[model samples]
Target: MALGGNPIFNGKSFRGATQAPRVPSYPQSQPGYGQPQYGQQQYGQPQYGEPAWSTQQMSSDQLQQMYKMYNRPSAGPAETGRMTFDDVIVKTAACLAVLLIGAAISLFVAPGTSSLLMVVGALGGFVLAMVNTFKKQPSPALILGYAGLEGLFLGGLTRFLDALYPGVGLQAVIGTLAVFGVTLALFKSGKVRATPKAMRFFMIAMLGYLVFAVINMVMVWTGVVNSPFGLGTSVHIFGIPLGVFIGLLAIGLAAFSLVMDFTSIEQGVLQGAPERYSWTAAFGLTVTLVWLYVEIIRLLAILRGDD
Candidate 1:
């Protein structure tokens, strides 16, 4: 299934306002004398071995004014505070910590209860996720809320899967981490990028996947399929469950989306974008990780069920 909750752009463009430059210090015809000229030597010959004044010693106000005038942060990618790919990684890890804590609580509180934690986590997480995604500006409150919701879902899912297949939760955790780590390394190594062709393929494949998911959900609700997995159980390739193959394809697509996220963050940092967008980077990453985890967990479940 496709990961839900992508941030929506309301089609608003950020317009930077331009103010008129400060008037020239003096008319072109006038001599420069208003500002202190310490570097000036007397019209007569200088006394032997006297030191010269340095611009490095300007007062803080003078330096700030100079920066405002000439070094104004460029409108393009070179804006200040834009988050780097490295920053996203660190933030994502921190968010994951919060998620793990929530999961731990669910596991301990209501062990082996499917609807209890999973429903709470899924519905709660989905609500908070919407709040965070559609928010005009990011808030720590909403982001943390999303994290907690995801944790509950993960914990319940882990407990359920682990009960069926001992240590499966641990395996899934390790697998998720390994995938994220390797994908990041490959992205940083410059061997992978979100090329035009790839993105187009991803969009089309994602659309097809979404349609299948909606149809499956309808089938389940209509009692057309007794299995919880719907069409995945009915369809098979050479005796292999269709869900397994579809899950693999979905995982591949999610992994490539991570690559695109990495590329976008890289461009933002190198262009010097405003630092506030780090939250956007964090959000994108969280979305991908959740998708990855869900895919892995579901794939494991399908394989286990195959037996």
Candidate 2:
């Protein structure tokens, strides 16, 4: 059964999925990062006839306090070093600005010859996406490359859709922005979260959706589904294309995916994750927003095609 939508794989890590940088552990008394205080005895060192600090000597309160002090801080807007939601927003906006520039060029200058650009964009984006995802050390060059490729793809796609429905591209853009805004608002308001059960459901649904999409693509490639939209157009319920329903589900999943992204960033900040992990958080968010836009555009196309 289709569960609630989530990321492509929940338990299995993506090859290039960025992770928060690990914070270096330090001794309890150290004032700064990763240095033992001068003349301090190492943990578990034996003292002459004195009681050794051990698990037995620590009270529950002391242990809890220690954990609290050392525990990572939450990812908040104004958190000290951790990546804030504001950082993610800024990066995402920068990406969209690049995308818009590319779209304008494709729409006005190049006109109908966007297929090549789309193919190039998709391939380039995939390569850069993988590089950024798997990179232990984040490179600004690679990250920007990924953004540029994505812009190309977005530009070509927008131009193609605009040619078909005239105003549909704008509509889709508005819808995408609205969804993103609402999702962010909800996240900030604490109305939604990446709870264990919801996350589990999201994982299950994502796997099933991926399998279905793959199968559908294969069928299309093999000429099994004669329709232009593969199984989406041909398979309909009550005169509604299957793709329509699926797209709606996908949009919902994307929204929830944003929530998860927010949660992850939040956790990272709260945990005092290293600052470099901000790039990772940004990448994750960009991936989700791209997915959301794709779904919105596709849905609009399906709707316009029906009419």
Highest TM-score: which candidate?
1
Model 1 shows how many backbone clashes? 7
Task: Assess the local accuracy of residue 138 in candidate 1 as a C-alpha lDDT between 0 and 100.
Answer: 63
TM-scores, all models, native as reference: 0.74, 0.72
Give the deviation of candidate 2 from the true structure as CA RMSD: 11.3
Model 1 global lDDT (CA atoms, 0 to 1)? 0.73
**Candidate 2: 10-residue stretch with minimal lDDT:** 1-10
Tens digit of per-residue lDDT, candidate 1, span 106-151: 7887455644878888999888877776776667667767887898
Tens digit of lDDT per residue, candidate 2, span 133-237? 667665656676777778778888888888877888788889988998999899899888777888888878887889989999999999999976787788989
Q: Candidate 2: which stretches are off by over 4 Å?
A: 1-82
